[model samples]
Target: MDLTTYAILLAGALAGGFVSGLSGFGTAVMALGIWLYILPPAIAVPLVLICSVSSQISTLPSMWKVLDFKLAGPFVAGGLVGMPIGALLVARADPQNFKLSVGVMLLVFPTALYFIRKPMAFRFGGRPADAAIGFAGGILGGLAGLSGPLPTLWASIRGWTKDQRRGVFQIFNGSVLGAALILQIASGFVKWDVFWLAMLALPGTLIGARLGMRTYHALNDRNFYDVVLALLFLSGIGLVWSSIAPR
Candidate 1:
């Protein structure tokens, strides 16, 4: 690729990494939209997965203590089941329409969550329900390389504490994206250009993640939630615009 493409990919990686570092999610929501402007979905999806895993692993040392199996286990099980189905769709679907639908849902659901005066105080689902959400997340991951939004929203609705939410976000994203990356590799979607771009993008990812983590540490729960809502809103806008943008 050209210098311009390299610059854009690195810049997108920085933004996406920072967001993932802060919230333990949104790597795809943040990066894929920007990358899509220059790359096809076929290349963009694998690149998103690769960079997302990179951003997520950078936070493990700090986040490992907060992970809760009871919360993440069933969801993971569901996600594992849903991923193959999503991957299959990747080969034979109208990606723009599918993404547009997801984009609309992302906009509507989070907006409603933000407006409610009295947010619920307790976790909202049983293991089965969590698994179902995970499965849906997996399908999205498979189809569009976006797995974080559904789980992130579910965690918000459940009213989890910051640590609880972060733990889920990181663990869930890592698991699903890692699985998708493996599938992508097996399918030969990862090309030399993807590898070289990832290498170039790495330093920016490290810097952005550190900065984001610092910001995350400074925020109170309310402020953190507000940030998440804003990020989700931006993610929705990005998705919608990408879906409708001229090719």
Candidate 2:
């Protein structure tokens, strides 16, 4: 790759890594825009899975104390069920309208999140609601590399503690994205060149994640929630920009 493409690759990795590290998800929103400019969707999409999973792995130790498999189980099960369906629908969907609609929600929802005087914990719907949300996230992830928002939004609404929210989405995103990566590999998406690109991404991903974790640890639960909402807002902007930009 040329120096410019190489630069863009690492920049995307680092940016996405930082967000994923801090928020437990969002690699696609942060990285795919720039990555798409340099690499085809075939390469860019799988590379996102690789770097995102890598970033999640590097930050796992911090999350272990808060992570609970029982809490994340239903979501994962729902995601697995939805994953293949997403793969089937990707080609048939109207990409622009779909993204624009999601982008608008991303923009609108975060504004509501910002207005909450305190973390408003809702108690209704529980596990079944979570599974349905996870199913939606899985479809979005598999379709557009956009999975974290729904779960993250739900967690916040559940009035979870910061770490609780973090742990659920981290485990949820990692499991779903990891499974997606495996599907990609089995489908022959990981060619030697893509592997090489991922290798180059490793250092930047780790560094960005490390830095993000440091910031993560520095914040109180409330500050972290605000940061996540801010990131979501920016992600909305990115989505809107990409949907309208030249492919």
Candidate 3:
């Protein structure tokens, strides 16, 4: 790998880990949006998973008390059920189309949520809705190393408190993404090339996570959401345009 590749890897890992630290989810979306422009989906997907897992390890423990395992259980189960199907799809997908789809995924969700003046907290969905969202998150997670957006969006719409949202998606993502990584291994996507790249990214991930956690404390709730959505929106546009541009 070239120095550029190494630099991009560290950059993505740092930014993604920072977001994950602040919001308790989003490691993959942030990272994959950057990586897909340079790396193939097969390599990028599992690499994002590794970075996601590391960010989780770095951030989860300090906030563990706020997490409610029971609250996250259904979502995790649903994600487990949906992961295999997503994993199956990637091997057959056109790489460009896969990137396009991920770009669209990144683009659409943030746009929709940006307009909300306050947490919507729709009354209808409840636990069943949560599970369904988790199932979808699993598919995305497996397919594009993105397991957080749907669940995170849903939680935000539900008007969950910061801790509540963090607790659920953080645990949900960790469980689902962990499973996705194992699936990648079994499917032969976890090679030494990706492994070494992940190793190179470890310091960046940890440092970013630490910095993000500190920033999370300093920023008020609204500021945090604004920054998160803004980054996603811009990255989404970049990924989409890249995927669709003529070679």
Give the top-scoring candidate (lDDT).
1
What global local distance difference test value does model 1 have?
Answer: 0.83
Per-residue lDDT of model 2, residues 194-213, tens digit only: 88999998788889888888
- In the order shown, the candidates' Cα RMSDs to the true structure are 1.5, 1.7, 1.8
How far out, in Å, is residue 47 in model 2? Answer: 0.9
CA lDDT of 29 in candidate 1?
89
Candidate 1 per-residue C-alpha lDDT over 125-175 given as tens digits, one digit per residue, 9 for 90 to 100? 677889999999998887767888898888887878888888888888889
Please write out the lDDT profile of model 3 over residues 196-238, one tens digit for every residue: 8788887888898888888876776677666667766766776
What candidate 3 gets wrong by more than 4 Å, as runs, is none
lDDT of each: 0.83, 0.83, 0.81
> What is model 2's C-alpha RMSD?
1.7
- For candidate 3, the C-alpha RMSD (Å) to the true structure equals 1.8
